[model samples]
Target: MDNFLIITCVHHFQKDGKFYGYGPFIREMNLWIKNRKKVTVLAPLIYSGIPGKIDLEYEHPHLNFKSVPAYHIQSWIARFKALFQVPYILLMIFWEMSKASHIHIRTPGNMGLLAMFVQILFPFKFKTIKYAGNWDPKSEQPHTYKIQRRLANSPFFTRNAKVLVYGNWADNSSNVVPFFTASYSETEIEPVRKSSLKEKIKLVFVGSIYSGKNPEVGIYLSKILKDKGIDFEFIYCGDGVMRPQMEELSIQLDLSENVKFLGNVTSAEIKSILKESHFLIFISKTEGWPKAVAEAMFWGCIPFTSPVSCVPEMVGNGERGVLLSTNPEEIYLALLPYIDDEELFQKTSKQAMDWSRKFTLEKFQKEIVNLECE
Candidate 1:
């Protein structure tokens, strides 16, 4: 029996005698442990609060969960408190590492950082590291993220492990594998019927309403489009700390009629929105794979996104989708041509869907199985 141990920083919750966590993360994990007889998860557990719309329950026959106290070092006080918890966290990881036959580490996180070091002590054990963050050598990131990236790329420390990262990087070791994530399966691919530009343009933003995701940029873009006398409707499909402020901004800008905020809807609802929408406005400052972009493209929604991470490659340097700029006017100018030209919009939409369909959940599962066998 394959004993699989997963170490992650994603917070899990227990409800009605079931384990739940962030929807997308949980979905991917379900695939990873599909064939394993025994599965152990080491993560933080939240004692209270109901699962959000995007939280999902884990579907495993035999699962063992080990809870670790969550800690962050973002502030001086936080750093001081985390100091005392280090020994306990390290000991927990080491004990789990000693028994597991196969270990999987989700990286660019506090728990993953510790597990990365612990796995080094068991070099002969088969392991896989999923670096679920920006792996670009030049991108600015937190100190701990950089450290995790360095360790993952070092063959000396990460032996007998496949380090799966979002994009292909030039400065990586032999074990570092370029990987892509998928939200939809081949069975979910359907013919998208999007409305023409002559009708009210339908734009959607499907991510966190936080600073890093740049949800405010979507509002600013809506203002630019409104000023240009372009009849449009902008929808936000996720929630965060900035939702209230963004809601107020919409009313203040007289965009309350044109903008709608649908806080944290189910995956099915998001797919339905993508099918009808003409464009996906996602100007996030950073991402690993940006599942939202891929999901949008899967539904024939052309994305207007920033040139961050592997997005340039995903968009084919403006062939499949528009690469955004910080300036709203510049973004407006770039977007106008696509809106005006039906041929260009249709062609680009097709290209985007074709590229995204190649990375479906079916293909992702096969890759995971192959990694385990290797």
Candidate 2:
């Protein structure tokens, strides 16, 4: 309980002559290390030749960082490199884990999967694995992902450990705990007003503009609206490999005027956009409890998303917003009615805001504190 050791697959980088990592991941960890005496982070710290748009440095001072060589199962070459490197990584984890009584592993990732196996060597150490991805017990996924879930969910395998997951799945292990992540603190909460349907519809799509999250779905939504001569704007708030491709597709669809891509912005900037936006079009192919969806709902921005993972429960089974289909035509038809009905729009926005506010960072941090202390 004195020292908190964090392990994850999130790559750390150096920019502006300072160490940096993903903003939201660092922010959540910042909340976690509040009461701890010493905090340590062990993960792959890559040296990117060029600068990144979303890299954020850790906020705490005088903290320890152990940079392990980053590896993945993406390509055959990478897999071969990892085969020789994994043993060294495991040795490093074993040594680092021995130094702390409290170990936190960020799961559904390659590094986390490795940590899950090594933690068995230290059953006496209390560990918490935060499964940041989809946790549907029956959901189809890769072998590695399934193995990590199996190891963590078995009391016999992973002793003295607890898993923090998005949803409450039936027939779970004793250590599996239902939990949530938050972006804003209780003090950051403000009076949220419903967006007016009379104005030009503004849709915000947050998350990496990758094929998996399907930024194309948002663009297609804009295309459908534009074809009907409807006045609306779709703004993408994150950057990824598919960003350029999505941008080109937007122009090709003749949606140049309606679609806007704001590469990557800070948490503050996104919240400002969410406050004024009418809907968050996050029709991703996969997600856990996406912080973007919850943040949008927190500011009275209705969500228009696919029922991936626990999104249906998060969006109140389409009561708070629109649940979409794979077909762009069907998605358009489902949303067009809400666009025209001002009263219905106002009602759902309120319900969404109320639900999201209940899961603030203050509450989230308290849960982490309890788990860490115990």
Candidate 3:
């Protein structure tokens, strides 16, 4: 039987009022657990008051789980605790890595660093590091994230591994590979229809409204359209730290009536909105690969985004959607023509869906099979 071990700092399942990381990682991890016979999960387990369950059920009888003490350095006590807990975490990972034929790591976390150092001891070890954040070095990142990337890409440190990253960056070691996320099937193709040139355009932005995402960009652009006597409306979904700021910005810009911000919505609700929208405004400061862009494109919302991380590649370098620069006026001017052209809108929507469908669950499963090969 093939033995497999996964190491991550993110909670696999939650017990308290807190949720774990987003659903994409949870769903992807479950794919391996359900398909493999001998699999052991090594991660922190939190005991809390929230409802928590695996996004996908495990059918394999041979699956096992081992919980480790959660390690972090958020506060003074937490830092001291992390210093003491790290050794035990290393021991747990070392033991599991030695026994398992496959080592899978989920990164940009404390456990990821320990796993990286442990993996170095076994130079010929078969492992995969899922770097699930912005891959570009030019973008601002935490010092820990930079260190992890350096270690993961160091030819002298990490060997015989495939480091799955969201976007392709320059000067990468042989280990880095560009990856994508998908939610639909090739067979379930539904052709997206664009509105007539004379019709009012609908623009949608989905995701947390943090300042980093710059949801105000959507609001500001809509205001610009309104000022130009263009017919358009903006809808926003998801809540975050900057919700209050967005409210103030909308009121200050006098876009309270034209722009609507709906918070903490479900996927079905988001899908309903995406189906009717003609374009997606997603101008995040940084990302690994913003799932919302792909999700919006799947439903035929032409994703207009800042060329951050792998967004240029994802949007086909403006073939699928418009790439924003540092200037908001430039972004508004660039998107005006697409809003006025029905044929360009429809063609781009179809191409975006076609490109996005290639990275579906079935394709992801195939890659996993190849990676776990005995």
Candidate 4:
């Protein structure tokens, strides 16, 4: 049987016995595995209550899942133990990697590090690394993350590998290829019923309310719109460590009437909410490919996001979306012009939707086939 070893640090196969996270990544793999009679997943698993996995159903005849302890370290002792656990984990993955004709890895994680080291032992192996994170060299990151990127891109370190990254970054090795996640399709496209430009606009922010995502920016922008006498409401979906702080900021800005936090939601529910929103406010400082932003664009919601990682590329270099400035005041002033422009809004929404439609599951699977082929 043709075998493939898929490795990652993220909790892919959860204890709930369902795969989640990196939805597009896993979905593409599931499709590609059809070519191989046998496929094995080597990754962490966590217990959860999430109903359905992203791609695979519960019973896939050709799939084999081997989960390791979630790469978790709290104290110095735990951290030391984790360090020792790396070799054993690598041994487990190497066994599968040796048997497989193709090897796929998700990098910048504990498991990724182990795989990276093991990959060095088999320089002739055919492998691919899907790096689902901000690839900007200048962006601040953990030491291990920086090391992983360097090693994975280094000519001497990484050979016979294709390193897939979210956005196009400078000075990348020949192996680095830019990629994107898809949402809807040409057939799925429908006429969006937009609200009147004269009426209150509905806005949305769907992601963690953390420093990286900068949920505060959404609140600040909403307050600016309110002060400008613009009738608008911003809804935030997704809970995070910074939820309490963000809620406090909303109240402090007297934006309680204009902003609502709906917390985390399911994909179906999120899609329904997007249909009702006019724009998606994502001021994230960094991203590989923000799925929420792409999803928003798919539903005809214009995105207002900071030009981080591949965001500019994803949004068609601001043709279909708004780019944020480092200065908060500048961002507020820049967007004020679009507050009442109906034609601009419609054109931008259509452009966003059209751009997102180009990257579909069918297209993604085709690319993977090419990558796996000689």
TM-score to true structure, per model: 0.98, 0.95, 0.86, 0.89
lDDT of 4 by residue, 1-374 (tens): 57777898755545444455445556556666766777788886655534332323323466778878676576888888878776678789788888887788888887887788788877788888888788899888888888889988886888898888887677899878777666554566676787775788888998877888888888878887888888889899888899999999899999999999987776667888898898888888768888888889888888888888888888888898988854657777766667757887888888888788777777776777787564
Over 4 Å off in model 4, which ranges?
Answer: 12-25, 47-59, 72-77, 326-328
Best by TM-score: 1
Q: Go through the candidates in order and give each one's C-alpha lDDT.
A: 0.90, 0.85, 0.78, 0.78
Pairs that clash in candidate 2: none
Please, what are the lDDT tens digits per residue for candidate 3 over residues 1-374? 57878888876555332234345566677676666669887887656523232132334567677789987788999999988888888898999999887789888788898898899988877888889888898889989988899998887899888888887678688888777665555665676666664777888888878878888787778778888888777888888898888888888988887888887776667878888888888888888778889888888888888888888998999888888854668778887677667777788888887788778778877777776463
Worst 10 residues of 3 by lDDT: 49-58
Q: Which candidate, 1 or 3, would have the higher lDDT against the true structure?
A: 1
Indicate which candidate wins on lDDT.
1
The number of clashing residue pairs in model 3 is 6
Q: State the lDDT of candidate 2 residue by residue for 1-374, as single tens digits.
A: 47789999898886665667888888888888777788889998887543356666776665688889788768999999998889999998999999986899999898998999999998888898888888897787888988999999998989999898888888688999988989888898888665466678888899997877877888877888888888888889998999989989998999888888998987778989999898888878777789889999999998888887888889888787778876778878877777888888888888999999999888988898788566
Off by over 4 Å in 2: 15-18, 49-53
The alpha-carbon root-mean-square deviation between model 4 and the true structure, to one decimal in Å, is: 2.8
Q: How accurate is candidate 4 locally (lDDT)?
A: 0.78
lDDT of candidate model 3 versus the reference: 0.78
Q: Where does model 1 exceed 4 Å of error?
A: none
Model 3 residue 60 lDDT score: 50
